[model samples]
Target: MHQEGTRLPNEPVLKQKHKKRPIKTLFLEADEDHVAYQDSTNRFMKLVYVHEGYDLTQPRHQLINPHYFTGNYPGTDNEELWTEVLDYIDANYQPEQVYLSGDGAKWIKNGAAFIPHCTFILDRFHLRKYCKRAAVGIAGLDRTLYQWVLPGQMKFIRDYFTVRFNDLTVTASQLQSLKQAEKYLTNNVSAIKDNGLTAYHGCSAEGHISHYLSRRLSSRPLGWSSAGAQGVARTRIFQLNGGNITRFLQAEQRQASKQAKVTKLDRRLHFK
Candidate 1:
């Protein structure tokens, strides 16, 4: 936020339910192996990967794998990354329209703004999930809630939550969820309204992020150093892109060998 070109932050970190705790988690004590106080951007890790697919059921992320950035995630890196993706798309394919979908994160929105003629869609998966969590909280007091929202009774379900919210009967958890939903909706009201009225495809980035990045880097009891995390993330992304992992390993080995020789020369000069 202190940087020159940073637009005002619009992403909600306040109520985000993430695998790694909030940025405040960076304050803890760490043993010699790891660093204390981790944020969304930095972690150390490793991975061994196999191929993944984007089938007919979930095809939006077919061409590109999730690109992981380690250490600090800066806007410059994001801009350059998005530019590379766009250039790749333009080089190989013809498209009638290009639409960008994300979790209403400020960085995602900011990046989308730079692309010419990009249509921004608030990801349906997250929108629905947050609304559902909020709705359940709103109706937590209703014993007969199961009967109130059947497959064809979505309108009733929506109204049920609305009425409960108005009545001030929501539980604490529901209140937080409601706040999240409201902020998300308020921030992207136009998108929410249009989404309700229009027919559009669902987004699979959430699932993709979980499968490709979060599972490997953020979830469970695992922790990461920035370099190890980035090295594995790069390798995973390469595998997803249909690149040869063996070749990548070989290149890394050559680079490492050259760097080791340089370090050896430096040590000899220092000792002399």
Candidate 2:
């Protein structure tokens, strides 16, 4: 009821509207909660999404309800959060291969390892983000190869920059920047042009974050406790996934009324 915006478009709907369709692949995305707190302790929270059935061949899927987990939880590996992500996909979507693309964090890499049949594609959005920072070293090739960059031509670009760099007599700093840029690109060459690697092209995390989470939670000035934060997140995600809040409340009331009747019957029998 306290939602900020007036225009929440329940517009784009998932393909498997009725019957379940086996997912060919899925994309995993994790984002941080900027204002996470546990009673003013300044704790951290992560919002992770497991979305499937979005490939270049087909229409993109709607936002699947996300899984929210608190960071620094007890009794788990570092990959605990992502492990849960894999589990969520297994239970619901049953995709054949999960195409993972996200931050190049150790934990994210480890998540791909967790899934046996997972293909790790360095999401172009994140890859280009780092590329931009390191691009200064590559003679600002990002500007020159603007179109090529999106099409997954980083290897060609890298080779061109290599030759260009060797010819130029530059300062150590410039050389270091070039080397850094080259290494970053070289390491992620396979992930470049991921659309060729898989039917689905890019990571939709940025857009989803804006539409689902940030627009309501972070962009506004609302504060939340650990429970409150997680609650709103789960609620909003469910709404995005086509859940009706009114029907949900009615169902809860019905269940509560049924439980009360059962309790009264048990008490009457005991008294008799």
Candidate 3:
């Protein structure tokens, strides 16, 4: 019997290149608060990840992932919590770019250093909240000014303040108020600029936090178990990532099938 050498197919093999998935930029918002437990205290850190170009018409806005870390609030070692959270993000998502928004907390600023590559933005609504409180408390301004300025009236307020802040020679009281507002604005200028374009009242991140986490946690004076709190927070993140869970699952399944097929083929060719 003549042994025939196997020849590769003569037909032009079409190498269909897989199109690269578009790079997604994620907006990350995080906050840590102490949650009371029955016998002890738990510090819960929540992260909300939002991607650009995600369809908002779905049930939840395009939340990519939600992560929660809970532990006993270590006075000075809380930074470790931030490090763990950053490591989780880096491992799971591998996001192209991250934009962080948060209330002006010292821990938030300090923790952010862990993810130095991320674009840190202050929570704009928090900035306005501080400004309004200062306006009323220190400047002796009325509710009307706060209401108007908290909305998209920042430009008008800034212009008005520009003239007013200059004209009124810096008195002790005025100086105090100006200093307060200045500090808040200086720290949160980027968040304000990014959010000011919107006609809405509050920062989107703040709204998400209130709706998703705060409403449930702050509804009544209640204690939560560390595991239970972490579970709920994690679930909320998945919910916010929208209905894309199905798509993600489907993609994962397809990849697994493809990998399995390759493995099976390799085994067949190499079998003794």
Tens-place lDDT digits, model 1, residues 1-272: 11211211111012334342122100000000122223544422211111122244554434222222222243432565455445444443344444556666655665457555555666656656555665564445332433332122445645655775776666777677666655555566554443442323345555555676566656665555544455545555555554565554566679899999999999999999
TM for every model, in the order presented, reads 0.56, 0.61, 0.51
Q: Sorted on TM-score, highest at the top, how do the candidates line up? A: 2, 1, 3
Those runs of model 2 whose alpha carbons end farther than 4 Å from true positions after fitting are 1-23, 36-45, 50-88, 91-94, 135-198, 267-272
Q: Residue 63 deviation, candidate 2, in Å?
A: 7.9
Cα lDDT of model 3 by residue, 140-222, tens digit: 55355445443446665666457646765557776677667656765565555654433212226556556666676645687
Best candidate according to TM-score = 2
In candidate 3, which residue ranges exceed 4 Å CA deviation?
1-24, 33-54, 57-60, 65-73, 93-96, 137-179, 194-204, 223-272
Residue 137 lDDT in candidate 1: 46
Report the C-alpha lDDT of model 2 over 1-272, residue by residue, as the tens digit. 42411222222223444444577766676545455354555433455566643444446654444433323222223566666565556556767777766655555566678876777676666666656655565556566554555566776777766775876666678668667666666676666656466466466666766666667567766666655655566567656556666766566679899999999999999999
lDDT: worst 10-residue window of model 2: 4-13
Clashes of 1: 6
Off by over 4 Å in 1: 1-72, 75-77, 140-174, 193-200, 249-272
Instruction: Let me know the TM-score candidate 3 reaches against the reference structure.
Output: 0.51
State which candidate has the highest lDDT: 2
User: What 10-residue stretch in candidate 3 is worst by lDDT?
Assistant: 1-10
- Indicate the residue-level lDDT of 1 in model 2: 40
Residue 162, candidate 3: alpha-carbon lDDT = 72
